[model samples]
Target: MKTIDPINTTNPNGFKNQASAALEDTNLQTALQRAKSGFIEKRKKAIHLVDDFEHLKTQAQQAKQSALDNLNHHLALFEKNVVASGGAVHRAKTPAELNQIVLKICQQQNAKLVTKGKSMVSEETHLNAFLEKHGISTAETDLGEYIIQLAKEKPSHIIAPAVHKTRQQVAELFKHNHELGERDLEEIRALVDEARAMLRKAFLLADVGITGANLLVADTGSVAIVTNEGNGDLTATLPKTHIVTASIEKVVANMEDAGKILQVLGRSATGQAMSTYTSFFNGPRRTEDLDGPSAFHVVILDNGRSDILNSKYKDMMRCIKCGACLNHCPVYGAVGGHAYGDVYPGPMGSVLTPLMKGIEQATPLPNASTFCGRCEEVCPMSIPLPELLRQLRNDQATKGLAPKLQSMALGIYGWLARKPRLFQLTMGMFGRVVKLFKVSHILPQETPAPDAPDTFVQQWKKSKQGHSENE
Candidate 1:
């Protein structure tokens, strides 16, 4: 794996520059175009087949809201249940704390190598890099994760980590990394077979396996996970000790609630009616079980989520890690996940990265969108993403985080807008300037002048008047 400074990978202020470069990168653009169509059409078709998709989303949202509202109560119940099932629960308040807990577990087991399923929480804490630094080898079992792991890159998308890599790129990566002599590398089947062959050994040799939970059922103390590739099952069952790292927001009341979210999760994420493997495990292998872990541990991390619960961003907690928002985001399709430079990318990432990484550092992320409501439209949780983004922008401005000149300009504009006559005069002058620039070819011919009679403000006022009349 290539060396990466996980701490400095994201640049909230440099997002514009990163996005600009990504827009110009031909290979990335091609990959994004290829993925964009399939995800959108598949999700759309899947939803069309369900008559109660909206109702399911609403039920899922209510369940998450209920869990979060009484988080302490549910967490205690979940812990009690896990203990009853013979699994230990560990609590971590920060990423460093979470890493240390996992490290201690590995050390106690004398684990030299670890196998991992696709865990976004692990990515958030840079677990792989941390483990490697401590002389422990970790292998990513998911095909996309394995590719990015070999590339030493963080996951760009939540579910599909290596969506940015084309098959040709994967073949090249395999050629560079693996010592295969003139193999069939062009076909995806060949690539999967190659990855499977290589990872089979890692799975067998690993002393511990780690995975993320889709939802933690409080009633049963079981961690439910959905995977199309079944790597998660292998990661959880094949090793001596299994550790599940999950966010606090993943806890739900019961299996019934899990079923409600599961209805939309597969449809919104991969367009499948149900994932290939939807498995639940409460404890280590029982005496009757043939093959399973001897020990089970659950590490729940609060990080910044507790604060978000009482704040305006609480709706974001309803997110199920389904990549529907990413698939529908136009900006995401154009530049791909790396542009955001975080574990979670696309519309969800834009809001989340800032909250998790600090708005001061990730300032550009909230403003990266075109304010299209497609993210909210396709979200399985029905999170009001656009409204949340607007709130973030408002928070940013309230903190005086904007550049001095930009703040001054906005202040001036605010004052002028209060005086309609002056505001109209300024608009007329700006339009004239744009028309002059157009004639001189300074501005693009396609650009619309601000002086147009049907400017946005005018249209808004007209619509407002019509609404008032109807009322």
Candidate 2:
């Protein structure tokens, strides 16, 4: 994979330093623990209530795979339907192309400020930077995205972008940024209301609103948005022109297929009956409707996804960003999102960043996980995350991106393992030898200073002693 202005993933010390600093942030730790537990409980209860949860998973997986297999055929159909519904479809092959298409529309419409919902594709393309460069002001309307944007931080969690922010942290952010008086804003609802009031003005005055679709239906050319906050509705509706930035992979065959995915999406993400607002837009506003945008534009970005569609990494395109994987990820729970230093994070990020960006630029990410398959179990799509991760690891090795030490070490082990006698001898001698070390570990990569085994080797030796005596 090719990368633009890549960062050095070769510096092991740099990643260690960054991850260490993240681990030390007590506020982030507390917030993550609280959010993770709360979300897990909510999801478990929601899953129990949904009678067809398992059924939905199967249906959703099949639908997604089928859609992916015939994406080209469906995409063309979607463009036709979009035009038929009075919306323009713009095809962009790269991030720069997508940015320019949106900016050109903004220029034609004389748009000064663009109100935006949480669109990861936009963030991926550095759309905010691009817009600002073109003399257009852009603000994130999603509450979590808004908070992170003000703090100049990337989202750690895909669903709850600001899940790492404590109430106290929020108060400070609001006080420092909004100057919302000296009095405390004790209620979460009050904080939400405050954000709503501010966003209302932006919504009313903005010429164009931008959002990312949860899925796009090829049969009808509809962009489906599932949100609990209801901000998606306002952002996409209140503006004169609504622009959607989505990739080709997010399309499904029809609304029925979309429902299958949506059913599992919230159940696996935050545990809700359904997202409070599940809005579907079949183009721009119709002439008959009293409300809705007059001009609607859909910008489909390919980026690096087309290449993925043709390779082993294509399974990743099935991701709906439900964030279930991140929610249960131990490493993500430890360091939060900032440590990833990219728009996406956690186990999903591990498999994705490398494929989307480049293997060398994101080598540290794949190793960040513990090979825990909790992500796969919770994933409604059943993407087999651990298997894919191992594939990525293999790819890393083939590309000469893995650590040289690890490559050499595994090679030696494999050489011995091929000969049963040699392997057993090595293991016996190794077990006997490690008894003298003050500390023991599988490798140098383990955390907490590689703790010493207090009595493991001795216990094994004693067991052997007992067995010999019995014999």
Which candidate's TM-score is highest? 1
- Note the clash tally of each candidate: 0, 1
lDDT of 2 by residue, 165-269 (tens): 898787677777886677667888877888888888888889899999889999998999988888888889998999999999999999899888888888898
Give, for candidate 2, the lowest lDDT window spanning 10 residues.
Answer: 1-10
RMSD of 2: 5.3
TM-score of 2: 0.90
Q: CA lDDT of 260 in candidate 1?
A: 84
Q: Where does candidate 2 stray beyond 4 Å?
A: 1-14, 440-471
**Predicted structure 1: lDDT:** 0.88
Residue 99 displacement in candidate 1 (angstroms): 0.5
> What lDDT does each candidate get?
0.88, 0.83
What TM-score against the true fold does each predicted structure earn? 0.92, 0.90
Model 1 vs. true fold: TM: 0.92
Candidate 2, residue 358: Cα displacement in angstroms equals: 0.8
Give the range of the ten consecutive residues with the poorest summed lDDT in model 1: 1-10
